[model samples]
Target: MALVPASARTWLWHEHAAVPLTDAPPVVTHLAWPPHSRSRPLAALVRTAARLAAPDTAPTP
Candidate 1:
């Protein structure tokens, strides 16, 4: 039984046959990367993660 964000419940349930603990406390997540890294793919991934973490701050078309 792992603790994960509610947003991941569906994917984890479908992909890993995992079940949620209804009484579990919420989890806080953080992302980190090298401050001087120059990987384009990693940058893109960080951007995507930021968007998902805070949809309200994501730019709209």
Candidate 2:
């Protein structure tokens, strides 16, 4: 995968996602935010790495 810097076109590559390790139904295990977002741009970038890595069949939040 390529490292995308801009937010606008970055999401376009997100049209697809990585596969999951399990076949279980998708679920939200947890959600979190950095302290005032001191590091990353969004929670989805860090918190939902697993979800994003897998197929995007699950409904969007």
Compared to the true structure, candidate 1 yields what TM-score? 0.51
Worst 10 residues of 2 by lDDT: 2-11
Clashes of each: 0, 0
What is each predicted model's overall lDDT from 0 to 1?
0.70, 0.53
Can you tell me which runs of candidate 2 are displaced by over 4 Å? Answer: 1-27, 40-52, 57-61
The residue-by-residue lDDT of candidate 2 on 1-61, one tens digit each, is 6433344453665675544335455445455665677665575565466566456644355
Candidate 1 lDDT by residue in tens digits, 1-61: 5666667766664547556578766665676788999999988987887777657755553
TM-scores, one per candidate: 0.51, 0.23
Choose the strongest candidate by lDDT: 1
